[model samples]
Target: MVQSERAKMADGEWYACLDDDLGALRGVAADAVFEHNTLPPRQRGNLGPALRALLGGVGEGARIEAPFHCAYGFNIFLGPGTFLNAGCIILDTAPVRLGKGTLLGPNVQIYCAEHHKEAAGRQAGLEIARPVTIGDNACIGGSAVILGGVSIGEGAIVGAGALVTHDVAAHTTVVGNPARVVSRG
Candidate 1:
């Protein structure tokens, strides 16, 4: 039997993003996100439980500030001591892994999905997904955008508003659009 669109998506192959199964999954994720975002600040402690029910994995002491968003919550994995500041958005069309002690500043955006570069394919809603990995102790600054297939190395620091399109080396500091390494140790 041929593979389903969802199966192809999981395998990181090109697939239609508007498929019914994927839409249903997104609906479930949206509902969960809505509930999590709507909870009062006094009940912030309950956020972990809410995320645990939605995400692929949520390690101990991981905290995400309210108003977070994601395309598919189940594709996100957060490690121990990870903290995502307010307004972070993760388009987890594929797996998005944040390693232990990683810190994401406010409004950070991580996208694992990409639409076709050509107009015809885009019009058809064809898309592909790639996994994004942030290694242990990495710090991503406010408003940074990490695009699909990028891997941030352990202990790397991404400056505010960086647009990361390629892998960052361990212990490096990157800044600016199409992020360039400014320091390496």
Candidate 2:
């Protein structure tokens, strides 16, 4: 049997972004996100449970500040000690893995989905997805945008406002648009 559009999406293949099943899943995620985002920050009692229910997996000591946005919460995996500051947006069309001790500053944007390079394909709502992985002890500064298919290696540092379109080597520091390594530890 041929795969459904949702299956194709999960498999990281090209798929229709406007598929009914995918839209339904996104709706569910939106509702959950809305509930989580509406709660007052000081109300710590219910926050953890809410996030745990919404996300795929939330490890020990993982903390995601309110106002976080994702296409599908179930595609995001937060490792132990991962901290995501306010205003973080993860377009988790595919899996987005944040390893242990990773720190994401305010307004960090991670995108796992990309529209077709061809205008006609894009107009047809065709898209592709790729998983994004940020390794252990990585630090993504405020407003950094990590694009699809990028793997940031362990202990990598992405400076504020960086636009990362490619993989970053282990223990490297990258900054600026189409981020280039400024240093390697």
Candidate 3:
């Protein structure tokens, strides 16, 4: 999996775009620290607009908590009425599609790219990308990491701390590292 210098340069460019999008997020993170001390969080008003401006395109009524991070806002796409709890991170180096009505619990990380495991390739900072797709109405529990090229089927429930490396069947529940289908929810 040897990669060219051009690929490395492209990855660096992607990183730069991410830096630009997250520039506002740095302030959002700072705001969260003080936001909790306020009398009412609702009184603070919905900050969804602020976040939407930061991401690629956040659909109507999508609520994303503070302290969220994404690489290259252009690489991410989220549907309407989706809720992402605090500490959600997306490395959308490729493309990440989140369907409508999806719920992402705290600490969920979706990564859309991976570096070559070969030591020489890694040394060059070369990488490759694969898109991640989470289907409609799916619920992903806290601390789950959805890796690249994974398609989590519609209405599937991914348990807490699951490291999903494969595609999940529709309308099922999966758990554990390299997640296994536990039941049909």
Cα lDDT tens digits, model 3, 52-125, are: 45566677777766656765556677889888888888877677888999999999999876876778766655
**Predictions in order: lDDT:** 0.92, 0.90, 0.73
Candidates sorted on TM-score, descending: 1, 2, 3
**Best model number under lDDT:** 1
Q: How many clashes in each structure? A: 0, 0, 0
What is the C-alpha lDDT profile of model 1 across 62-125, one tens digit per residue?
8888898999899999999999999999999899999999999999999998999999999988
Clashing residue pairs found in predicted model 2: none
Residue ranges of candidate 3 with Cα displaced over 4 Å: 1-50
- Candidate achieving higher TM-score, 1 or 3: 1
Which of candidates 1 and 3 reaches a greater lDDT? 1
Model 1 error, position 4 (Å):
1.3
Q: If scored against the real structure, what TM-score would every candidate get?
A: 0.97, 0.95, 0.76
TM-score of 3: 0.76
